[model samples]
Target: MPGPLRWLLFAVVLTALPVTAGVLVLGEGEPDTAPPETAAPAYSSTPLGDLDTATVALARAPFCDRIPEEAVAEALDGKVGPTASYDAGQAAELAPGIKDVAHEHGCRIAGPGGTEVRAWVFVPPVTRDRATDLVTEAAGREGCSRATAPAYGDPSVALLCPSGKRTWVSFRGLFGDAWLACSLSAPSRLAEQELLDRTGRWCVAVAQAASVVE
Candidate 1:
């Protein structure tokens, strides 16, 4: 399937899935449970102050490299896989206007047991206001809603968008002139609250790692 079509289909599957008390649909067969070994890492809800002045040089490297492998492993409770680079071409195909305002670069990090996290950095020339507008539009999309906890960065926002049996949880914030976001699809069978808690920690880890990137 084409990239856009595949994503659209995924979104449709997410919206169609039922979210019942204590259980969120994942797929056929019994709902899977999260083992204690894979529990969410401890985190602080405090926002990272340095993001207000941090900067990223995308021309020098992809954003994913800046995130520590150990942090990623602990956040998702899984082994980290090779990082895949997302280029401007893919961004244009998904959202054309993205290229006009800033240079877009992203990384998709795969975790053990099929879980995945994706992070992006929109290089300078993209203002905080524009970033806020983009994040608001995304949060308002069907099956997507705002997440109020575990916030970080200046003018930050978080969202949870259910897709099929899993939920896509993300955190985004504007740091200086750049926009950064981290998103992940939670493992199936975990309770709704557990899922949210895990995603929140994942966002915090990504933000903490991003904050130190010069």
Candidate 2:
């Protein structure tokens, strides 16, 4: 469940956009069909030790500012899973799953904006999923948000850090520019591992989010 404040902001944004009224797909009570592959890629080039400096600066900017660092960390710091770029059918299949998860957790879902997977918001009903076009500042850059488990329960996003457990996830694209990353844990586990494994997973997520054009 996105907070009331977040939901309100989302609603105001949603109203301003043109709504193409139609039914959206929701995932089956079944498991995800994505094959067991490598995790997605991580988009940030800067090291995590130095995240605060760049992130704080970016947070002050228009689109970047909307997201907090904690949220970014959860979404970007994961083990790279499957590597396939979702086709329309796959995206459609996946979109519903994302939505189902969002609704179950109390967030909202929205678009297929850029080039990756269809973008979705897991905020309150009041909050609208503003297109990257609307938030000119957030155009190409990918960002993320976080809510307590009470609000969002578990996130739609998934990351596979080398640690045995799965971390929560959230991500969004900023004004079509550089990407800003924020991961929750210390990098020693995945970051220190061979093959730049964690970074690759983050990239896959970004690529999937960017593919959508909603």
Candidate 3:
């Protein structure tokens, strides 16, 4: 995906793509913690590094077959501080610090707090086209802290916090279409800076995964 026209085409393709049975329906202005049973299943279960023929077709299925670098870049731009680079293979590889960071922050290892969070990726075909959006958790209704978009804003990529506490970051290429909301519980031991660093790096990996050739 490259430019606007291509993006538009990709959007159409996305719209036309079959909505999976596992996808949960999210109303606008919902919180990011909504149950997955209600969200839409946006991507297939293809292996991350191996881009098979079917996987490539899925990646290329966007309406215009455009490179949506602009959309992706914009969403990721303002979210976090500087990030280290990781190719597709590396993106799948978790950083050693992730565990330490999560543990230090009081987040559970695999339980509610510090475990590996499941994620999905939306690869729009063009820059001008709307980038796909999804969240680590489902979207929820607005409350004391923040408000969710009127409808399911994006279904391709999302950022999330599992605790009940409130946190927000501006993702450069991702913020526009991407939505993020975290759980209210504060981390047990990790510093906020460390948590942000870990999450931020993971997001960068997501962006790169969407662009890199598997």
Candidate 4:
């Protein structure tokens, strides 16, 4: 379950309370259908070069800061804001199942105004079905609802959940073998189009920078 402070930090809301029966917990809505197919990334099947564990760990650290300033400006229609990132240790606490992504990475970008945007990354060096399973499990948590958005990669999925004073979007997709999960949130006043754009555009850079294939 997502803690109260985590909800504030991510601007999330709880719509579907968890119904626990034994060890099982289910969300109010079923996971959205698998994301639409897209061009697979090369690294999806190919091995990530000499980028060893230490190197990959360093690359993922401070990932929120990794997205270039220019990319964020373009995503928000030139509305730029300071960005911050967190590793899996912190990312997992932000919400339930965020760490489900392999090599899970995280970031939070202040909305140029009142909204905030966060993105998560998963590297899975596996076939499409394996990637789909990961995506399904990540979004199946309680309080999340499947949403319609451009699939970020092969076998991807997206969802929307409540955020305090905002709407939060959760998107996870398999690009080749890399699975990515991202969330965009903004004050109710912010247009939904902008949030969608942020998730769609920023994810491109994430896909580009991702080094973990499994």
Candidate 5:
């Protein structure tokens, strides 16, 4: 069966697009760990009363589609070609790292010079310290040294290691319970400094929108 996002792609062609404000969707606060994928039992494999609901989506760019093409072009200097915007269900099916934590999300960008970035915001609030430790341990398993990198005023952390000829970098941190993260696989692990800064900017944007963090 075609994926839900694949279906959205097909529909996007047949519809008109809408306008959105910025890169990050602000004002939503966080929340968690999941054991695994488990669907509620089939209820005796029998039919139950069905509930019908209608969904009305305003005419606007998709969450991922809001990633400004020009910004991506300027940042990565590459063609932003065919891309997929995954909805909550789509995120669940496609992004394992995020499906359990975030439902509404966007992809980092992939472009010229063999550069790529991916990001996520966690829900149910993984405290800053816990997020740091969790990300650090994951990075360690990949042979990366984990540490807390500076993010100006915001709390931040990093996981950096060299893999073969390339480098792996993951940057993540939190503001309130809403946490943001980004990973970059670039030519030098040092290049991650830029990514860390970018992720921090996004986090600040979100926090500002919430009006809770200074």
Candidate 6:
């Protein structure tokens, strides 16, 4: 070959070598080893025996009438004041929902020393998925955290939130296609576990009462 042509070929080969080497290096790069995302915690699937087959409906009279005063007193560890009831319209406004899709019958019982309990049952027109979503969202509130407790319904979530001088305990669960929620507020000095236990008892009582509504 002539000198000029041979030199041109040599230069082209050198340039192609680097390009090929770069391709090979990139092809042999390490695989992605990043950890997988964590999954949500698992919960029990046991249904509440009493509510599993009951025909759940809003109580004809005030829901407070179904809940015995003794139950309330035991749950709060003190005597309770008069119970205030919220009808469907008022309950719809007070409870959170989308376009008032949920019709809830709620009641508030005042307890001694700045403590209180509020319970509500979501009647027909409310879907179970929507109720579960609401419960999950409530558990994710800023100061709220999930707590371990006995399963009340098919599945249940309990949460605790401490605000200012008061601590709030909440429990929500699904019974058949219906759902119910309850919240208790007490002085922050109360033990969190104790509050959770009380809240659970109150929740069970409320659920039992609501399940038998006609």
Best by lDDT: 6
Question: Per-model C-alpha lDDT, please?
Answer: 0.62, 0.29, 0.31, 0.56, 0.46, 0.70
Model 5 lowest lDDT segment of ten: 45-54
User: Model 3 over residues 1-214: C-alpha lDDT tens digits?
Assistant: 6799899998888876656322444444457895567675543322212322122212221121122333223223332222222222223322223421111011111223322322232232323243332232222313222122212123322223333443332122233332221121224255555444444443343333433354
Residue 23 lDDT in candidate 5: 22
Candidate 1 residues 1-214, lDDT tens each? 7999999999887876655422543344575586566767764442333233234222322545666666677556787876666655454322212333225666667777667777766654467788778777877877788876544455677777777777777777676666767777766577766666666666655655555444
Candidate 4, position 61, lDDT: 28
RMSD of 3: 27.6
Please give, for residues 1-214, the per-residue lDDT of candidate 6 as tens digits. 9999999999999999999999999988968789989986642222233344234443433466677666788667798876767766652434322234236777778888878888877665446777677777877788889887766554568888888898988887676666677878888898887787777777767876776433
Clashes of each: 3, 60, 85, 11, 4, 0
After TM-score superposition, what is the CA distance of residue 120 in candidate 5 from its true location, in Å?
1.4
| Quality of model 1 by C-alpha lDDT | 0.62
As a whole number from 0 to 100, the lDDT of residue 29 in candidate 3 is: 43
Q: Write the per-residue lDDT of candidate 5 for residues 95-159, one digit (tens) a residue.
A: 32434423545465565555655555543456667766755556556477774554411255566
Which regions of candidate 3 fall more than 4 Å away from where they truly are?
A: 1-114, 123-188
TM-score, predicted candidate 3 vs. hidden true structure: 0.27
Model 5, position 94, has a per-residue lDDT of 31
Expressed as tens digits, the lDDT of each residue in 8-77 for candidate 4 is: 7554333332324322534435576889889854322111121122223223323555566666655555
The model with the greatest TM-score is 6
| Rank order (by TM-score, best first) | 6, 1, 4, 5, 3, 2
lDDT of 5: 0.46
Whole-structure CA lDDT of model 4: 0.56
